[model samples]
Target: MIVFFLAIAILITIKIIWVLCATSGQGSFDREKKEIIRRANYLTSMVCTSPQGLLDEMPSGIGEQFQGEWALYTCSMTSAALANIAILYPPNKELSIKFIDQIIDIAMSEEIREYDKLRWREDPMDGIYGNLSHISYYSHLAWMISRYKQIGGDGKYDDLYHSLCKAMNRRIRKSKSLNLPTYPGEYIYIPDMLVAIVALANYSSQYEGKYSTTVDMWVERAKKEWIDKETGLVASFLEAYNDSVQIVLPVKGSYSALNCYYLSLVDSEFAKEQYDCLMKNYKQGFPFAGLKEYHDRTCLFGMDIDAGPIIFNLSPSGTAFTIGCAASLDDMEFRNKLLKTAEIGGSTVTWFGKSHYLLANLALVGEAIVLAMRTSAPQTRMRNK
Candidate 1:
C-alpha cells in the first residue's frame, strides 16, 4: 500500500522502502513476480520521464524557496533504483543505461546547476557544506554515486562522490548517533542516516578500513533510537534515548517498514529480527493479511504524512514496501500474497500513457522499491575492478 501522495505528502523518502502478515495466495508465483516487475518497470520509467522543469521549492530560513527535500529525495530514489536495476534486474540492462542517462541529466542539467548557483539553499559562508541542507541533501548523492559506479559509471562522478562523503563524514563524526542533522536538531529521518551509512560502506570498500567500523558503530547506536521497547518493532521517530511511549512515537508501518528496507541492507540480521517483530505487531489480517500504518494505540488517529489513508488500518505504503523486505528475507509466500493484494486493490494505474498507483500516483519511490526487492541481497554491491 505504499500510496505516495505526490505534491501533498511525500510518498516515500525511499533511498524506495517494509510489512504484511497475510499468507493468502490468489495468483500463481510466476504471475505475481511478472506483475511486480511490470509495475516496477512502469514506475521507474515514469521517474525517468518526470519533468525537471520547475524546481519544487519551499520556504527556507526567511524568504528562500529551495529548501525542500523533494528534489534531493528524487535524486536518491532514482539512483537507488539504478542500483537495483544494475544488480538485481539484469534483463533490463539496456534499458537501465538509458535511465542512468536521464538521472545524470537531472543532476547536471543547466536548470539544476543554475538553481544550485543562485537559489540552492546553503550557508552564508562559502564553505561547501556550511549549510546543513547542503550536507543533508548530498549524503544520498554519495550513496547514489557509489551505486552508480558499480555499474561502470564513468569516473566523472568520482569527485562528486568524494565531496559528498567528505561533508557527510564530518557530520557522522559530530552527531552522537551518527544521525546527520537534517534540520540541526534531534529530529532526524532514519532513511537519510541509513543512506549515509551505505555511502560510508561504499567509501570503505575503496579505502579498505576507514569507514567500515564507523558504520558498525553507528548501527549499534541507531538500534536504540529506532526500535520500540514494548513491541520491539521499529518506531516512526525517536525523541531521545528514553523508551517512554511518549518519547518513542508509535510504530507506523510506513517509517518502520522503510527503516527495515535500508536497515536490511545495513544490518540484515537485525533487520530480519525487526521485520519478524513488525510482522507480529503491525501486520494485521483483514480476513487476509495486510499491514496497518499504526499500532493499536495510534490506529484511531488520522493518517500522517508518511502513512497515507488507512483503510481498515491497512497502510498501502507499509504493505507495499514490505514486499521488498519479504523479498529480502526470501519470504516468497508473503511476498506473493502482498503482490496479489496490491494488484487486486487497484493501486497500479495507467495515466497519460504512464503506469503508476492511483492512491498516490507519485509512487516513484515506492515503485522503485518494488524493483529493489527483486534482489536476494538488497545491500550495495561493491565492484573492485
Candidate 2:
C-alpha cells in the first residue's frame, strides 16, 4: 500500500516537471503552428503515400466497425490542422493548400469511403446526391472543403461543395427533428450533426442565408430538447426512431467539447454557454488537469472507445478536445494547462524535423486530433448576436 501511494506521488511529480520544462512553449501561436506544421508534414506524407498503411497503425481497440470511419476522421483532422495553420500563419498558406488538396484526393477516394458505403449500402457521394444519409462521412468532407476555401484555395471543389450544401440543407428540412444520423440507423449523435450544421452555417454566411433557416431551427430545437436541463451540456446522442427523439447519453464531455468546438465556428455566444457548462461540470484535477468523460464525477465509468482511457477521472478524448474548445473560446489559461497535460501524458517527441506524440503515434487519429485542437482559433460568428 505504501509503495503504491509512493509510486502515484512520483508519477505526479514527474508529470509536473514535464509540463513546466518540456512543453513550456506550448499554446503560443508560433509554437503551436510550428508543431502542427511538423505533424502535418508527417501525416500528409503518410496519408498521401499510403492511407491504407496508415490505417494499419490504428488502435484496434476502437473496433473494426469504426476502423474506416476513423481513417476518414484522421485525414479530416489532419486537413483541419493544416487549414487552421494556413489561416493563422499566412506564410504557410500555399503549402497548406497543396497539402489539403492531396489529402482531399485521398479522403474522397472510394477506399476511404468504404466504411460508410458498407454501413449505408451506397457510396457516400451518391448518398449525398440521393438522401445525405451518411452524415459522418459527408459532413466531414464538407467541413474539409469549407476549410480549404477559407485557407485561400481556389474554388477547385466548388461543384462538390455546392452539392453537399444542397443535400445537407434538404436533409435537415426533411428530418422531423431537423437533425440527421451518423449512420443509416436511428442513432443521431448530436456532435456529428453539429459539424454538418456548422458547415451549412458557413455556406449560408457566404451565400446570402441559403440555409440560415435550417441552421436556426436546428439551434432552437437543440437548445430546447438536446441540452441537459440540469447539466446544461449538450446530450451526446439521440434516438430519432419513429419520428420521436430521445436522449441516449446525457452530457458527456467527449462529445460536448467537440460540439462546442464546432459550434464556436458559427455560434460563439451559444458555444460560450455550453463551453462554460462543460468546464464547470466536467473539468477535473489540478496542476495535471483534464475533463472527465462522464457528468457524474463520482461514478467509475472506466473506459470507452470515444472517451478513450479514463484515469483518475480525466478522459483522454474529453481532455484533448477541450483544448479545442478552450482555444476557440480564448480561454488561454485552460488551453495552456491542458496543453501541458497533453505533453506530459502524450510523451511528445520531435525527430527528423517532424513532431508527434510518441504515445499517440501508436494511433494516428489521436495525433491528428491533437494537432487540430491545438491549432484551432476563434472564428467570427455567423449569426447576429
Using lDDT as the measure, the top candidate is: 2
Q: Candidates' lDDT values, in order?
A: 0.59, 0.80
TM-score of each predicted structure versus truth: 0.74, 0.91
What is the lDDT for 303 in model 1? Answer: 60
For 1-385, candidate 1 gives per-residue lDDT tens digits of: 3354553345333211211221122233344344445554665555555335323322233122232344445555656665565555466655665666566556544444433344334431244566354444466657767767666566777776777777777767765555544554455566666777878877887766567877888878766655678778655655434322223466678777777877776678988888888898887767446677867654543665455556667787788678778766667778766766665454455444444445324434445554455443434332211
Model 2: lowest-lDDT 10 consecutive positions = 376-385
The positional error of residue 245 in candidate 2, measured at the CA in angstroms, is 1.2
Q: Candidate 2 — which residues are off by over 4 angstroms? A: 1-18, 299-301, 380-385
Top candidate on TM-score is 2
Rate residue 304 of model 1 by lDDT: 51
